[model samples]
Target chain A: MNWTLLLEQTLNGFQFGILLFLLAAGLTLIFGIMDLINLAHGSLYMMGAYFAATLTKWTGSFLLGAILAIPACMAFGMIVEMIAIRTLYTRNHLDQVLATFGLILFFNEFVRLIWGPIGLDIPLPEVLNGSVELFLGIRYPAFRLVIIAVGILVAFLLYLLVSRTKLGMLIRAGASNRQMISALGVNINFLYTIVFGLGAALAGLAGLMAGPIMTVEIGMGEGILIITLVVIVIGGVGSIKGAFVAALLVGLIDTLGRSFLPDILGLFFSNDVADTAAPAISSMLIYLLMALILAIKPQGLFPPRGA
Target chain B: MKGTPRIIFIVILMLGLGVVPLLADYFDEPFYTVMFSRMLILSIGAVSLNLILGFGGMVSFGHAVYLGIGSYMVGIGTMHAVEDGIEWMANGFLQITLAIVFSALTGLVIGAISLRTRGVYFIMITLAFSQMLYFVAVGNERYGGDDGLSLYMRSDFNGLIDITYDNSLYYLNFVILLLSLYLSHRLINSRFGMVIRGAKSNEQRMRAIGFPVFRYQLVAFVIAGTICGIAGVLSANQTEFVNPSVMHWTRSGDLIIMTVLGGLGTLFGPVIGAVAFLFLEEFLSGITEYWQLYFGPMLVLVVIFARGGIDGMLVGLDKWWSRNSTVKNEEID
Candidate 1:
């Protein structure tokens, strides 16, 4: 519990929080605009990681691989929307859930077939392979710092695109009223496809960022997908600002809780009790937060105005 | 006109299931019996889920947690009996009671919290709670942690019904399945069932009409979880092992698929769906290890093209045949 250690953990949490925000922003946008639940969004994340891994190896450059993988994931997302997701818009939520659940299964197996059962490891570039001295003898991984910076830049760009651009105007209109916008001559379906692709690209970006730190493997999407879902729920579904705030909160709480809870519990409980209970409790921390939040504010902390 | 075809189909299915044990013995292939027993156990779980999802209009994504709880009750009880010499812990009746109680309590807490939200929120909340339990199970080292625990012995009922034997266990599963189907039929057609169904169709309207909709839904959720717990007990016995894998969120998805494939809101649909799904899994895996590649797309197609599932299709066929016969009568006239 030294100052440097605490500072380092806080930075780690912030870095992790950025990753969650990247996934959540796209998900919230898609949910807001189309009113569709895409459970397979995580598959896109997994695909991005795999694509980045392959592209990186082939090109021998992490930046180029990521640049290529984003569009690839976007195209894949649009294709999925046209084929499977288009019909689900009018269907009930349950059907949408089941269909997306199927897509998850399909994507995982497809990845396994293509990538093999073994996980692919993405090696960081030489420039980011070392640690950076922040200040006062405290150092942080340079790669993680890059992730935070990229995440913040992306978040800023997303805000501009959603609020300042014509497409963003249409997106806002669609979220508020789909038929009204369609009646006004906007190609809502095409717009949906683009928005869906954009969401996929964002998820892909998250996967690409995560690749160097984590293994790129089949079913990687599902593990993070659930957490993303939790983030959306906590953030008040379909609210980007809510998503951003909630994602960071959940990340910091999860990371910090896991790191410090056991030691804190040891002060009161026996060593064995603290050791056994900490992991279980820490793993449950965010979910418990979600439950408490939902109980108190059923519409979530920052539900969309008028919703 | 009286749903004669559906009744006949049910009769045939029941009789076929009834003779599985005897047929397995005659063919000297006990594997079919074991597999069918597993199917029946899962069918029970699916049926419980249908009570909430199909009829009650509550899509609980964590229904399988009760199954895990049910399995662990027996698993941990067996561990205590063997290792700590607690003979009473091995009693099948007590194990089942504890499992039912724990499952009911969990369902109550989950339902109370999740039922407050509607649609996608409910789904995500339920999933989160189950994932919470899953992580807890993965972290508990005393109960074998991530690796799960092996039940050294099945719970003994002391001759009330010896489940150690395959045939007896199979019969027990059959009887329970029959009883559950009967219970579901009675419950769904009752006044209470009407309230739950009404709420599913239109919750606001139900509430406006002075019905305590939340209470009814919570009751249904608890009942469903408890029944799934019974299935869990049988599942643990049948598999002779319990692990964290049983509680995985994917397993809950499997339960949803089975319920939907059989025919949502239909009493006997879960059984049919379970049997068909398990058989399909076995058949596909026999052909290739990467069966999910085929299976996943098939599910997507079912959602897109075939909404009613197997039972719905069967009912549709019967309607078509009866309509054609009436057409012939009109021509003759």
Candidate 2:
């Protein structure tokens, strides 16, 4: 393998992992704090991409589009939470699944109605469009580097918020024992609204950032959402740290396997056979990893301590 | 009046279904005959899924995989016979038995692995496994890839009814649906089903009582998967096509919706649910292409407001009617 190509792929994997972290973080938090499974989380991401695409088109500024989408997602999330998801707290996971599933259909069709099915594309800004020379031999896109920087900064902020703030303590407490948190006179409903909105904003951020790289379209969130679910399963349910570690690991494995598995298989099989078989195996790789992980640790790698 | 009203209602419903195809023939609307045939086939699927989801409390989000595998069995079998001149694969009984058996084996393996995980993990893992198969289906260039292959004619049953004829397949599907419903009804009431139901109600308790909960659950899971695999044969035969979309996660979701909408754990609920849900789809899509928007919220309403679903509602109405009559009996006495 060419060293430069390997490094570039690694960076690409890292960038992808970062986006996953953004999406999975919210999902884990919602699951952790609310004990709710929100299948519509991906719909939030889809709406964010659509909102960002629309805003950027109108404003002619990518950064502004992304910035505006965060709050927009939060507002929309709060509305949805009140209208549909709030009542699901008392019901079983099956009900939550169906209700949110309904939300998915509604949102997908609603987007189709507004966007007219033909997908939108976001162009990278001119300044970040150029390639940056990292060293004498390697070059990478400036936009990707910016994404890395943003992802890390967001990660840092999330760490600080979760670790240092009083609100974070409340969130942590709420996650473990909602009854105790409510006994302490916390408005559990308000807290849930905040948490749901926070998760939605995080997903929206991921979506807005992803728009320029991938097509902004209906049902786009679903493809990545399953991967995110695997990340959570690998990382351990309701653990942000696990989500982070798992996302990166999944991204690296997926990326590297896609690039090199065929090459490795070529050593044993014919080139034609290797070409055909590699992709199918690589596509199954993450799920296999998740299954293996679950078989060993059904609760996941880093399940939140003490419930 | 002495017996439960829901049973009375079910008898009426089945009788109604039995006669409708006959009525359709007389009315010259083979269209509705075909429609009810499709519903019956789907009801078989929904009913099988209900065995697991409603009765056994295993929320298998990937149930449609069985349907797709069943479809592909017939699709690929016919393709082999017609295109490659492979005679053995084209035998309908062999194809169906292999499909059901293969899907049951897969169900066993999948059940063995997935049953270890509970709640949300089970749901996600099942969805993931099904999706994994879906992608494989998408990538297989031999079987038409993303665009599905078609069966020129329905599977043949030698020296029996000609299923390729329009209403023959419909009647056959009705018989199969009736058989499946009867089998499921018996299975649910059998001692084995009692163990499964006991486990579903309280696994810890079931384990304490020395029930091999996992084995029972796995068996139930396999049975449900096999039944769904049979339904998949009907679906393939009904549509005369097989594609990855049949196994799509959304289709699995649709199965769940039908089960829930009908009433979990109650006999005949899923069939009604399938009819209501599919008929609504047919009606709404005819009115506007954006039918899903209405469908999505309507599902939400059913989940939110009608937790008992159509079957549960009927049961509740029966109870109310019985209570009113009992009061009259007291007054007369």
| Clash counts for all predictions | 0, 0
Candidate 2 residue pairs that clash = none
Winning model by TM-score: 1
Cα-based lDDT at residue B197, candidate 2: 91
Q: Write the per-residue lDDT of candidate 2 for residues B151-235, one digit (tens) a residue.
A: 8777877748788776788878888898888999999999999998998889999999898999999999999999889888878
Q: Model 2, B281: alpha-carbon shift in Å?
A: 0.8
Candidate 2 ranges with C-alpha deviation above 4 Å: B1-5, B331-333
| Residue pairs in clash, model 1 | none
lDDT of 1 by residue, B199-239 (tens): 98899999999999989999999999999999999999999
**Maximum-lDDT candidate:** 1
Indicate the TM-score of model 2. 0.97
Candidate 1, DockQ to 2 decimals?
Answer: 0.85
Model 1 lDDT per residue over A1-307, tens place: 6678788888889988999999999898888888888899899999999999999999999989989999999998899999889998888888888899989988988988888999999988899989999987788999999999999999999999999999999999999988999999999999999999999999999999999998888888888889999999999999999999999999999999999999999999999999999999999999999999999988778897757
> In terms of DockQ, which candidate is strongest?
1
